[model samples]
Target: MIEKKITLVPIGDIDDSLLEYISQSIKTTFNLNTHLIPCQDLIGCVPEPVFGGRYNSTTLLKQFHECLPGKIFKLVAITDLDLYSPIFSCFFGEAQLGGCCALISLHRLGQEYYGLVEDKALFLSRCEKEVIHEISHLFGLLHCSDNNCIMYPSNNIIDTDVKSSSFCPSCNSLIERALV
Candidate 1:
């Protein structure tokens, strides 16, 4: 069997530091090895210009699927553009939900997006939470009711900020089982 791992795919010009930070967090959180594929590897995954420039999250997810590594691995594609799914107007991220691919957008994670001053620290925190939430779903975990859990859906920035980056106890247990 192929070793299970997590691979970070950048949809475009993403900061290396940010990707490294998220990679480290994923390693520590799920106790799985993480790989960072440079931006060039995913430039092809960048969707063609959409009507308003907002890429369809599902389309990007499919693109990422084509680039998945041969080994059993979870692919998390990060981007700076806004993203939307057919089901929602716009979402922080979208996942195949128990499949091998997921996508997260950094567009809405920063304070500046809301007309506030830019907060890099807070933006990184929010990005980390979204990454964890989406990966957990790829592991077959669903949304949680606990408001403070990372798995809880964030309807707005406040919802994202209110939640902890760590998973709730039950969600953690589910993750543990999935790992096994």
Candidate 2:
């Protein structure tokens, strides 16, 4: 049987360190090997932003499915662009629930985005949380009620900062079962 692994695709000029941190975090969280693809020129290829410079995340997920390799067990695309869905005005990320493709954007995660001082540690923490949250959805997990859980939906940076990067007990069990 072919060994399935999680793949990380950088949508544009994403920083290497951010990708590396996310790749390592996913490997540790899911106990699965991770493959980081080279930066892709998706900014120009994807549809232009509709309004307020936000790209529709659902559309991007479809593009991700078309462009990403099929052999991987899961695919997560990281971008610095802002993202949104029809249901929400703007969000940190979006995933294909119970599906293999997920996408995350760092546009709003950074403190600098809000005109505050840059905090690298805080920014990375938010990124990790969002990455794990989106990937968990790919594994058939839902928005957990436990606010501390990684599977919890983060409506804003405060919610993201409040949640831990690890899964809560109940969510962890579900993840284990899904892995089987």
Candidate 3:
């Protein structure tokens, strides 16, 4: 059997610290070996921004799916660019349900994006939540009804803030089974 592991791909100039934090967070959260590959260029892969300089997340996710490495059990690409889908104005991240690829954007996670003073702790917390949420989808988990669960959908930053970084009991059980 192929060893299950997660590979984080930095799709542009994301901070080294943020990438490291994400790698460690995924490792701890999923109990999976996680590592980061060298930075990748998404310039030609993604099309031009359509809605208010935000790239279509579905398109990006498709690109990720096409290029995902066979040996990597899961792959999460981190980008600083803004992302949006046809169904939503913008989103923190997107993933292929039951697939190996996921994508996240750090653009709106930072407080400075809302014109507030930068809070490193808050930003990092949001990052972790969003990353974990997307990765959960890769494990065939759907959005949870529990508002406080990490699997609960985040309509806005406030929703994300209100939710816990960990899954609810039901989701926890589901993920445990999926991991096995």
Number of the top TM-score candidate: 3
Best by lDDT: 3
- On TM-score, the stronger of 1 and 3 is 3
lDDT of each: 0.85, 0.83, 0.86
Model 2 lDDT per residue over 1-180, tens place? 557788788876888898889888888888788877764533336568886988899988887777655465788888888888997544889989999888899899989888999999999999989888998899899988988999878887888888899889999999999888
Estimate the TM-score of every prediction: 0.91, 0.92, 0.93
- Candidate 1: tens digits of C-alpha lDDT, residues 21-139: 99888988998888877656654554775748778888878877775555647888898888878775447999988999888999999898899999999999999999999999999
lDDT ranking from best to worst?
Answer: 3, 1, 2
lDDT of model 1 at residue 139?
A: 96
The pairs that clash in candidate 2 are: none
Candidate achieving higher lDDT, 1 or 3: 3
Model 3 lDDT per residue over 1-180, tens place = 767888888876888899889888988999888877754432335457887898889888887666655566888888888988886544899988999888889999999999999999999999999999999999999999899999999889999999999999999999999999
Each prediction's total of clashing residue pairs, residues at least 3 apart in sequence or on different chains, is: 0, 0, 0
lDDT over C-alpha atoms for residue 177 of model 2: 95
Mind sharing the TM-score for model 1?
0.91
